[model samples]
Target: MSGEDARALPVEDARSIAGVPDGFGRFWTPYRMAYIHGEGKPRDASDAQCPFCAAPGKGDEDGLIVHRGRTCFVLMNLFPYNSGHLLVCPYRHVSDYTELTCEERVELGELTATAMRVERETAHPDGFNLGMNQGAIAGAGIAAHLHQHVVPRWGGDANFLPIIAQTKAIPELLEDARARLAAAWPAEGMEK
Candidate 1:
C-alpha cells in the first residue's frame, strides 16, 4: 500500500490496543500523535534520513552492532541485562506489520532464534524476553520501523538497582557486547 494509504487507515485507540494495561486511558497512540496532535505533519526522518539508516554497513566503530545481513541486522543495546541484549531491525524501513511480507516475517523469526541460541551459548541465560514495541504508545523509541528486541535473562538477574531505584546495572559496554557477539557470528548452521 502507498504511504498515504497506510496513513489513511483507521487505527484502534490506544486504550483499546491489547498488551498494555497501563497504556489504556493513559497514553496517545502514534496515530493520535500524528493525525490529532501534530496536525498530520510528518514526525519521522523524511522517509530516508534515519540516523541508523545513514549508518555504514559495518555499523558504528564505537560498536552498537552485530551482523548487517542481506535483509536485517542486529545491534547490542547500549543498556542491557545479564550480558546479551539486542534489537533486530529490517534494512527496509517499514512501520507496521502490514508492510512486512511472509518471507520477511519468517526470516525475522529465524534470526531471533539464532540470536537466542547464540545468547544461550555466550551468556547461558535461563530464558529470554522477546518483545516488540509497535509505536510510541508501545514505547518504541524508533517507532517508524517495527523491530524485535531479544533480551536475555537469568534467574535472579535483577538486583536492588533495577527494583528499588528503577535502574539497570549492566557491567559491560556496547562495544564489548558487539565484539563478543561478532566473535560468535560464524557458528555452524547459525543461519539455519
Candidate 2:
C-alpha cells in the first residue's frame, strides 16, 4: 500500500496491510516511568537522603523491612524486578563491600540467606538471583550505599515485557510481601 493509504487506515487495518504478525500482547506499565525518572529516590548519596540509612529509623511496615539485625537489615525493593524481591544492606552508609565491617559483612550474608529462606517459604519461587551492583558504572541504582539483591525467580518468569518495554509486572504488593516474608522468617536464630 502507498504511504498515504497506510496513514489513512485504522491501526488494525494498517498492521494487517503491513503484514505484521498477530497474537502479540501489550502490557502497559506506565508506573515504571517513575523509577526511570528517579522519583522517590534520594536527592544525593548522602546519609541524610540515603534510603538504606533512613529505612532502619522507620517502623517495619513503613520501611517495608522484613527483618532487622544489629549491623544489617532486610527490606523490600521499592522497585522490585519480581515479587518478593528484597535487599540486604548494612546499617551504615557505605558504598563499597570492603567498607563493611566484619560484623556487618557476616550479618549481611546471614540476612541474605534468611531472606532467601523466607522467600522460599512464602513465595515458593523455583530459583533465585542474588548479587550486588557495586557502583553507577556497575548498575547500582543507589551507588552511595551497598546492598545485596535477592530476587526470586520461577519457571517462565522471564518474559519479553522487560526486554521489549522495560517493564516488570510485580504480582504482589510490597506490604503484602513484607508481611509474608516477615511471618516466614526463621525465628529461632534471628538476631534481635
Candidate 3:
C-alpha cells in the first residue's frame, strides 16, 4: 500500500506492512556495514595486508594514529566500542605477545599507559577498558597481529542500544578524536 494508505491503517494493521510507524525510532548507522562486512580486514597473515603493520607506514592523519613511538604506535580503532578508543601495536608483524622483543614489549606497555593518560586529558572518560584478544578464537578481529585495546568508558555507556540493536553511537568522528588525542598527547619523555 501507499504511504498515505499505510498511515491510515490501525496500529495493529500498520505494523503488518513495512515502513509502519513503530514506537521505537531507527538508529541508522549505514557506515557500520563496512565493519560488519570486514572491509579493511586482511585476507592473510601477510604484513602487507595487516592494518597494524600498514598503519605505521602511513602518515599519522591518514592512519588515524595518535602517537608513534620507536617500537610501538597508538591509533584510533577503526570500529571502536566508544569514542576515543585506541589500539597499541608493535611495528613488527607479530601474531602474539610472546613474539615481542624486550624493547617492543616495554614500549607497548608504556604506550598503553600513555594512551590512557591522553584519553583522560582529551576526553575525560569516567573509566577505561584495556585488553588484548589473543587470537581469532579469543575474539581478535585481526588475528594475525597483536594489539592492545584501550577503550574509554563512561557511566550509562552500556545501554540497551548495543545489547538490543548491536549498534554503538559514537559522539565524535574518528578524525576529530584522532586530532584531539594527538594534540593532547604529552611530549616524548613527559608521560611520567
What's each prediction's TM-score? 0.69, 0.82, 0.87
Choose the strongest candidate by lDDT.
3
Give the root-mean-square deviation of each candidate in angstroms: 14.3, 6.7, 4.7
- Number of clashing pairs per prediction, in order: 0, 0, 0
Better structure of 1 and 3 per TM-score: 3
lDDT of 1 by residue, 5-118 (tens): 544545543333454445323222233343334342325735565534544444455537776665777777544545779877777778786688777787678788888877
Q: Mind giving the per-residue lDDT tens digits that candidate 3 earns over 2-91?
A: 666766777677675756557765556767788778777775667477788889889999999999999899999999999999999988
- Provide the lDDT at 76 for model 1: 77
Candidate 3 lDDT (Cα, whole model)? 0.88
Candidate 2 stretches with Cα past 4 Å from truth are 1-26, 43-47, 188-192
Error of 3 at 29 (Å): 1.5
lDDT of 2 by residue, 1-192 (tens): 765676787766766763674745444455677878976566555747787888999999999998888888899999999999999998888889998899999888888877877777778999999999998889998888899999999999889878987778888999998998888887757532
